[model samples]
Structure formats: structure tokens, C-alpha cells
Target: MPRTALIVIDMLNTYTHEDAEALVPSVHEALPGIAALLKLARASESPVVYVNDNFGEWRSHHGEILRAALQGRHPDLVEPVAPDENALFVVKARHSIFFETPLAYLLGQLGAERLVLCGQVTEQCVLYSALDAHIRHFDVVVAADAVAHIDAQLAEAALRMMSRNMSAAICSADGITFDARRAD
Candidate 1:
């Protein structure tokens, strides 16, 4: 049995950064797909983990981060895909979710073998996370329509890299499936 987990990365953003001008629209576009995937994951009893960037706010926790994002730039965008009570959150200081975070230990405890990744900055955080997951021998799946990037070209290239190098499954949200039997 291969336990699968949904890794929602950096989607709890305020979109107030310098790159937000180029990134916010794509993030907004990806919202529906992300929400759909979340619904499906929950209904199937799959673990939904949110791997968010701490943005150097060392004192802030997950709740604080969410609150700040809701008050920041794009509340409309942040409101739709906000983390629910059931979601597990891990805060990372760097682009990669596994970096300086309890994500690896947490996923191991969850018995996650396959990771379905969705969320913001496809070329940056998502890309790095996929590579790290691959190195750790976890099956990687990138929800294509569920991820947003600052630049389309770079994102496409990153996806190609993930597919060719990490052998990640690149597909739309509809292609994902959550099975309760997959985990212990």
C-alpha cells in the first residue's frame, strides 16, 4: 500500500510581494482547481498538509500567518483556499518544504509514500520540494492546473525538469485520486 498525501505549498499568500503583480492572477486562476482537489482529498480521507513559507516571520505561527495574509494584499484570493481545521500545516523558512521543517518527519509519521503537490510559485518552492521528495524516494505528482507561477515559461521549464529528472507525474486535478486504504 502506498500512502498518499496532498502537499499544499505557499498558497496561504498575501500576494503583496514584488512578484505578486505577475503571480497573483495565475494564483487566482489556480484557486478552483486547488479547492476541488482539497474537497476530493478530504472526502477520501487523504491527509492534506499545507507547507507554507514563513517569510522570515520567526515569531508567527500558522494561525498568525493566515491572519496576516487575509489582511495583506489579496484577501479575496486568500479567502477561498484558506486552510481548514483538518489541514496539517508546516512552516518553512526556505523555498523547499522539507528545509528546516518537520515535513519529512510528519510525512513519515503519516506514512505518505506519494505526494500530490499543489500551490504557488511553481518554479520556485514547488520545484525544490519535488526534487527533495524525489531524493527521499517519495513518488511525486504535480497538479498542473492547481499550481501557479510568477513566470509561465519558467514554470513550464520547471515542470519539464520535474518530469524528466524527478519523474514526477504532471497532471490536472481531475487526474488525482485519494484512497484511504493506501495508508495505515
Candidate 2:
């Protein structure tokens, strides 16, 4: 086995905020499971990648994003939680994280052969990332409970497609355990 990473996409509370313009129910419920995966990644020392969109705006850097999300008034459109020092943030302009981001290079440097993708909008970014990882010959695991979509039916269907069509392992967050020694 090779190195693995825990990818949490768009878990920002901004998307889940009670007054978010784009709030989705599936993502809201995904928080607990996302939290569980976050805990696991932190506990296991596995690298955590946050694939967040620039909200098609901001026109800012990562630091500015943090500032706006955490301190900007006017109900900023971002989750107000600070990421850990080791956690890496990738701001994506398109729906796909791998489209033009450093994600490929980061994963290569991390020696990550398996990417555990869990986050919001099962049919969009999360789906794109998972499929990209699989096509790239990376082991892709999609945590069912840790991800959500506005349409539960589509989310469920997407999971099936990922598992049966793309060879993704759809497991629960609690069932996942990262082995650092295995990375060696």
C-alpha cells in the first residue's frame, strides 16, 4: 500500500450556514460525518486537503479567503472555521479541483495512491474529483455518510455509479482507518 490522503471538499459552514444562498440539505447532514473524517485524519497524521471553491468571486488569495471567512462581516459566504497548520487549502475556480489546481502535484509529492474524498454536492466537485482520481489510477474511496447532495436520490444514485461503475469504495466514516505504516 502507498500513502493516502483525506480530502474534505466544501465542508465550510458557509455552504451550510442557516442563511447561505446555496444551502443544501445533504451537505448540512454531512457535517457530522465530515467531522468524523477530519478527526480521523488529524488522529492518523494523514494529510487533509480542503477543496473549496472561490465562490466564483473573491478574486483573492488563500490568506484573504481565510480573513474574509473568519472576520469579514456581512454574513460572508464561507465557513468560519480555521484549518489546522498542516491542513492544505486549494481554491478552485471551476467545479473540479484537479482541473487547474496544484492538487496533482501535491498528491504526487505526498505519494498518495489512495484519495479518500468526502464532502458536499455528491454530483459535482466531489464526483469530479473521485472520477479523476480513479482514472489517474489512484484508489478512490467515497465515504457515503460524509458526503451530501441537494437531491438525496441523485446522491444515492451517484454513489452507486461511483462504486459500481468507477470502482470507488463507498464506506462510512467510522469504518475508515488509515495506516501510516502501510504508506511505507
Largest lDDT belongs to which candidate?
1
When summed lDDT is taken over every stretch of 10 residues in candidate 2, the lowest stretch is: 72-81
lDDT per residue for candidate 2 within 13-73, as digits (tens), equals 3343433444455555676787788888888788888877765566766666665555533
Q: Model 1, range 56-108, lDDT digits (tens) per residue?
A: 89999999999989998889888888888999999998999998889999999
Off by over 4 Å in 2: 16-23, 70-82, 181-184
TM-score per model over all chains: 0.96, 0.84
Provide backbone clash counts, one per model.
Answer: 0, 2
The lDDT of model 2 is: 0.74
Q: Tell me how far the alpha carbon of residue 95 in candidate 2 is from the true structure, in angstroms, after superposition.
A: 1.6
Q: Which of the numbered candidates is closest to the native, going by highest TM-score?
A: 1
lDDT of 1 at 7: 94
For residue 144, model 2's alpha carbon misses the true position, in angstroms, by 0.6
